[model samples]
Target: MERGFRLILAASLMLMLLDLCRGSTIGVCYGRNADDLPTPDKAAQLVQQHNIKYVRIYDSNIQVFKAFANTGIELMIGIPNSDLLPFAQFQSNADSWLKNNILPYYPSTKITYITVGAEATEVNSTSLVVPAMQNVFTALRKAGLHKKIKVSTTHSLGVLSRSFPPSAGAFNSSFASFLKPLLIFLAENKSPFMVDIYPYYAFRDSPNNVSLDYALFESSSEVIDPNTGLLYTNMFDAQIDALYFALAALNFRTIKIMVTETGWPSKGSPKETAATPDNAQTYNTNLIRHVINDTGTPAKPGEELDVYIFSLFNENRKPGLDSERNWGLFYPDKTSVYNLDFSGRGSVDVITGANITNTNGTTWCIASSNASDRVLQSALDWACGPGNVDCSPIQPSQPCYEPDTLVSHASYAFNSFYQQNGASDVACSFGGLGVRVDKNPSYDKCLYMTTGSNKTLSTNATAIPTTSHSLAGKVHTSKSSWTFMISFLLFLAIDSIRGW
Candidate 1:
């Protein structure tokens, strides 16, 4: 019995280790924008109970930080936007903030990065983010914690005036002044430009324009960007690239951007009555997929964007929009809000190890994002194929994407969007039509980003047809000299006619 017990124990340990490794990634943003909720200690337990290994919070709540200590739950803490001016003014305050909130509870608490602000450039946010981030960096350095901890801020999707085609990325020129400096900081510090992008919002706000299939991450909704002529089945990538377009326009194309806060509210106020349980599950299902399966964006193929979903539990105390308090994976009572599974993740059956590699929602985000092929390809065949989105938005004179093939038609609809308010080259290297990923890898050269990284395409010229025999060898090596001479004469005649 003792030997059997030992064997079982050893087996269990190995399994637990594997589970932990898998779950190490894929985090949940634990936003406490509300005043009421569970205490830090209890909340920490609640997070663990769900087997989520990563947590992102808006403020460096001591209780929350302390609660997660030694739990191996990676954390991302933040500073309020209002504090930006103060921290920038006094590095001492930063030092004090760290000493009081960070230093003492660091390694034990697994405090990872320090977000300067939560979507600082987003709606209703102050414009002092750039200065605040600068101050935060300086203070972190003085405290000797800059290297160990990253300093950055987040923004809202609204930062981009337009986002449709993945290729035509650009930012709102109005926000450009503040965004330019912020992008530089992120690039310099090796930090990510965070954005709070919600496809649900797009769907709700522009229901007539945004397709449900696209927002829901369903397989059928086929969206094509005209600028690059790349096809997109979902809206998440489109939203991210809009930020990319904005950054690229400002000449900050190299900066790596991430989604800091994104999610669909399970419930909503009477005005936002459209919020439903099913939609929430679908949004999360697809969102989790893009994060885990490493689906590349239409602009940057193969490059995976880091994402943090908003909130672990519903905050009854949250104010304002009803949706504000509904973006939780769980309720305050420690029960799951919905039954959507990421990577089919759930602890109900047996709580042993982390199963976190975020399988594309066993039910949600399953289109080009991966694993789940739930999209009914036949159903969406038409919308994504050709002549779908009514182009009352783009003016007639604008040189837009022409409906060619199924791929070209949809890609063009989105590609013509001028967020950065300009265009460079419009060449179709592949048959002079279809999507083209800039093949350059070096810094000076901008490879047209297409959902790929480290050799996105498996092989080049796959579609081009060619004969094995060399034309020159075949013509010149002909056994009959007379025939070769005649061929050469014909070639010369043809060249002369072409004015060669």
Candidate 2:
């Protein structure tokens, strides 16, 4: 009996760890500043379809809160700048606002963070931010949700006076009074300091100094900060570390940072040549990959960071440059502006025409031509075993078993694992043995699995188990650790059954 109980406990722990490991750190800012945008329900569905798990909105719309209820997607809702004075002065007002806009839908809505006033410094309302945040915190405390739903305000990068050499980063003295108290509030409450980091603006302002490649996270060259001797690879990290240094300077290094907004516009005025669909795709794609991979900044290597991509849909009402209205991943019609894998594993193909049903373009993974048979076989074994790829279709007497070559077998398994994992670039990279191809490699009766397709076949050419291959690609495991845990669990189950 004791042994059986122990086995059950071990299984439970493994399941919990698996749950913790399977989620995306990337989120999208669901800004509805356009009349053409889809309804809140439709928007929520769209977010889920792409496997995106987090969302940040500009306001606490009850409709949005209701639409997202029980969706399991976490939300970071905002309290608008205009409401700051009232929320700041009156705890009753904050409490009423929360009770009406938040409490009714929360726990079901999965609302996590409450951002009070976005970029208050930019709006010249910095004075109201901290007080508003305090009142909101008080309201949450009264409702016994102070710990669950954190309160913070978003700041623009303009808060920093010097962000060049990341090590020498410091907040502007003009905003010192506002920042000091704000940082203290955040540290005391164990909340994150939310900031909007826009590399696009930097590149736009100084095209000569800021390399486009650096902003897009595709730079091969490194920028070494002379002061700290820290090597910076991309502008995103440098920008983030700048804030990190600033926080440390204020002796508030304990406060975690969350990227409240970041994205590139798909379209811009003629003068804003850098804003294009291609650049936007590359920037957001690489941004997702960077955050999900946990490749932290030079100052904080491998630290977990949560980021939200700006503007889920193009907002026609947003003021300023033409680019201001075009920073959207999707059109109001719910079609993708361009292909993007929120899973951070692979590239997405650009969507065209009215065919919005299949957003995942024709992409496949195959054994690399340069890879040796030994390497192919090794990868095949890993994919079939530890990789959790469904390999029954590649067995003898199966449709895919005919060619019988190591490459052929490896290709089938690699594609299965790749497609199962949202057709990500990293998923197909079986230790550099697998490669992604645009052309479909399916020949004869062996139908290969592609992203957004559920036609996995076996010897009988019938559909195999597909429950594991969710659109979100939530299940993730390391090569060795996952295998060991699974094997141990299996052993435990068998032993427990026998003992019973």
RMSD of each: 23.4, 9.4
Lowest summed lDDT over 10 consecutive residues: which window, candidate 1? 469-478
Candidate number achieving the greatest lDDT relative to the actual structure: 2
lDDT of 2 at 280: 98
Candidate 2, residues 1-500, lDDT tens digits: the string is: 87768777767766765654543367889998887888899998888776666889889898998888898888898989988899989889998988887888879999889999999889899999999999999999999999999999999999999998999999999998899899999999999999999999999999999999999999999999999899987999999999999999989989998899999999999999999999998998788778766677899986667788897899999899999999999899999898776555452222212212322356788998788765566667667764656687789998789788888888988887777566666676665677887666766667666554332222323333222312232334322234333433444354445556
**Superposed Cα deviation of residue 413, candidate 2 (Å):** 10
Q: Compared to the true structure, candidate 2 yields what TM-score?
A: 0.74
Residue range 176-247, candidate 1, lDDT tens digits:
678767777888878878777788888888889887778877858567777777778788887777777777
Following a full C-alpha superposition, what root-mean-square deviation does model 1 have from the true structure? Answer: 23.4
Q: Score each candidate by Cα lDDT.
A: 0.57, 0.79
